[model samples]
Target chain A: MTPDQILTPILDWLDLAGVAVFALTGALVAARLNQTFVTMAFFALVTGVGGGTVRDLLIGAPVFWMQDPWVASVCFGVALIAWFTPQRWWEGDGIEYADAAGLAAYAVLGSAKAFAFGVALVPAAVMGVVTGCVGGIIRDLVAGRPSIIMRPELYVTAAAFGATLCVIGLSLRIEQTVVWSVAALAGFTLRAAAIRFGWA
Target chain B: MTPDQILTPILDWLDLAGVAVFALTGALVAARLNQTFVTMAFFALVTGVGGGTVRDLLIGAPVFWMQDPWVASVCFGVALIAWFTPQRWWEGDGIEYADAAGLAAYAVLGSAKAFAFGVALVPAAVMGVVTGCVGGIIRDLVAGRPSIIMRPELYVTAAAFGATLCVIGLSLRIEQTVVWSVAALAGFTLRAAAIRFGWA
Candidate 1:
């Protein structure tokens, strides 16, 4: 298969998965805050798509969510789920694992897309880190909490590692599927380790 | 004179003035935090261009700072000034008055640009408010402070009123210069009054 044929389906799935996971987190924040349903949905939408939106704008691409009909619907659906469910239902390591997976996928996707947009290698990697972390940062900001960036966490570092790897792999003309898979898995492993060991 | 002819020059000046004032505020925030020069410069650039950047991205216009040569330079210069000056140099109501004026001008400019981009009336007005307020919102977020939006202040309200007036006037086919001037003056007056009387 051509690189496009291999990467397209994977990227599409990654994009949706990332948005859904982030949206759930956003809605959970609002629910914890005792905000209205509207607020929950708004938070879901912003957090779900915030990073991708920033990446697209920076790379001068048409905004991904604006063009994709399903993204907003997914965010709304996630918000509804969060609203109807108790907060305790989501209390566990499950959400963190999902978020870690999403983060890695998003980092890989962001770097790949940026490289395709003709961004320089370093910036493409930066875009990857941004795509992974900015949504959470924005969520904290709008929710009036300290940004995750201010915390001594391995979150951004894991994303940066994945993004840099993706950029490097692509620059080396590696097989697209292998590069993406390896980059994402490596990042997810790092994040999972961080979570399991309570790494700062 | 053509609407474009009259409005362009005014908008240009407004854009620069708004950017400079906001940049100063951003740099000042960093200075107070005792951050490094790089952080202050980053804060200044983001605050100076944050609102306009969002507006442009939403409206599918080219990101203004990326296109303009002078904007980054101006932000750097403002950061440098803040770096060298005493905190008390920015004390009192002088910066507040300047910020108020900048807020009004930015509101008018944002709405006009959004309308010109063919966004509908209400959203165009929202774009105005976004343009005037988002920079500070971002600054506060990055600085780990409660957003000014959470405060019971007249700040956003004044911007909204001005944006609404600009949109209404443009829709009514009033003279462009008159619409812009009246809109900006009305907003500035509200903000100034709020500052003077400590209006919540």
Candidate 2:
């Protein structure tokens, strides 16, 4: 099979996985704020789908969440999980690790999708960063907190690294599966290090 | 002529007018924050196009600003105006009045476009409010300020009034010109009154 054919199925799972993790973070934020179930669900939904929605819009594609019934269901289900679980369960660096993983995967997925949609290489990479970061930014903004971007974190930088690597790999006609895996790993490693070592 | 045909030409003008006024408000906000010229321009562009961009994305339309050459030009030009002019020039209720006008016109145009794109009635009205308010919401969020939605203003209510009216008129087969004019005027009147009388 061609690279795209092989990557398509994997991308689907990655998309759902990223959405669930992001949604969990969103719900957790609401839970910490003592918000109601409805508010938590809303937060989950927006955080899960915000980045992909922006990417789709910029690429002139149908919105990913609106088209997929399963996406909103996943967000709500994640919210329900967050609502019932004790905050201690999600404490420590676990969620941050998961977030880093999601950021890397999402960045790769975003750039890959953009490239597939005929976007130029640089813009495709930028789309990757946007897809990974915009959701959290939106979540923070609506919650009236300082957004992640305002912090001197390497959050966006990690996403951009993966996204840019993916685009470059695609342009070099590398195998899609290898490119995605390597790029995501590289990004995750960087982000994980940042979280673990307090890298700015 | 069909309502759409008659409204099309007028909608174009309304769109630009709305963009210019909203951009001014956005730039003004950045200026108040003592941001750089670049920040002011960025604020202007986002505030001017944020609502329409969201509307187009939701309705599966090509983003209006991306397709239009003049839209970004208009936003940047307005930013320049805000940058060079004294702050006192934009002080008082003048900008608020202009903002009210833009809000109403934009709401009408947003719903009209959504309706044309075959979105259903209530959702179309929601689109109008989104188009009218999201830009400012984004601006506030990025500026790390409490968003206007947090206030008890009649801002969104007025936009909804205009948007819902436009859709209802369209559904009832009212003349396009009359529908747009009446809807815009109704919204502007309410907003103006709120500004003048300090109505919440």
Candidate 3:
């Protein structure tokens, strides 16, 4: 199969999974703030799709969410769930681990997309980091918290590592699965360590 | 001259003026926060270009600042100026009036740019307001202040009025200068009134 044919389903599933996790985090922030359902939905949509929107725009592609009605529907669903559920259910380390997973997937996906769009490697790596972190940054800003990027953390650095690995793999013509898995694993490992050990 | 030819230089001047003033405000916010010169420059560049970057991305235009080196240079210049200036110099209402001018100009410019990109009238008008307000929103978020949008003021309303006027004039095929001047004046007048009289 052509590389596009082989990778399409894999990337699609990764994108949806990443978006769903990010949307949940956004809704949780709204719940923590005691905001209305409308605010929760708004936050979910923005946080889920904000990074990809920035990446696509910077790469001169159409905004991805605009083309997919399902993206908004999923955000709405996440908002509803958060509104109905107890906040305590989502209050522990589980959300942080899930967010790390989403971050890694998004960073890899963003780098791949930028590369596919003919961007240079450095900027593509930057796009990857942006796609992973911008959503959380927007979430924090709207929720009136200090930006995650401003805090001494491994978050952006983990994303950068993932993006750079993806770019390098692609440039070296490595097999797609190995490339994606390794990059995402590296990012997730670093982020999880940061969360678990309270690493600055 | 063709319309593009006629408006290019005029719009260019307005764009530079708006960006410079917004950059100054961003740098001032950094200074107020006791941030370093690097942080001040980063804030200035983001605030100076944030709104137009959003508008361009949403409208599928190339991101504006990336194409122009001078934009970053101007932001750097403004940051240096802010870093050197005393806090007392920027206190009180002078910066407020300058911000008002930038807001009006950005609103008009954003509306015109969106219209030129063939966005529908309502969305174009919305883009105008987004362009005018988003920079300040970003600056506030970075500075840890409540967003100006959350305040009870005529700020966004003034931008809406300007954008609406610009859209109407464009639909009527009015002279470019007339459309731009009237729309900007309407926005500036409202904002100035709000600042002077504490209008809600």
Q: List each candidate's DockQ score.
A: 0.13, 0.14, 0.15
Fnat values, one per model, are 0.14, 0.19, 0.16
Give the per-residue lDDT digits (tens) of candidate 2, residues A1-200: 64356556777788899999999999999999999999999999999989988887887866777767799999999999998989999999999999999999999999998788777665677679879988998999899887776566778779978998999999999998899999999999999999999987
Worst 10 residues of 2 chain B by lDDT: B1-10
Model 3, range B20-94, lDDT digits (tens) per residue? 999999988878776666567657877887888788778876666544546667887998989888989989999
Cα shift from native, residue B47, model 1 (Å): 8.0
Comparing 2 and 3 on TM-score, the stronger one: 3
For residue A138, what is the lDDT in candidate 2?
Answer: 92
In model 3 chain B, the worst 10-residue window by lDDT is B1-10
Residue B50, candidate 3: alpha-carbon lDDT: 83
- The DockQ assigned to candidate 1 is 0.13
Task: Give candidate 1's iRMS in Å, 1 decimal.
Answer: 5.1
Expressed as tens digits, the lDDT of each residue in B1-200 for candidate 2 is 65456556777788899999999999998898776665676678779988888888888776666545577678879989999999999999999999999999999999998888789999999999999999999888888877989989999999999999999998999987899899999999999999999999
Model 3 reproduced share of reference interface contacts: 0.16
Superposed model 1: Cα runs more than 4 Å off: A1-13, A36-39, A69-73, A142-144, B1-50, B62-129, B142-145, B148-200
What does candidate 2 score on TM?
0.61
Chain A only: give the TM-score of model 3: 0.95
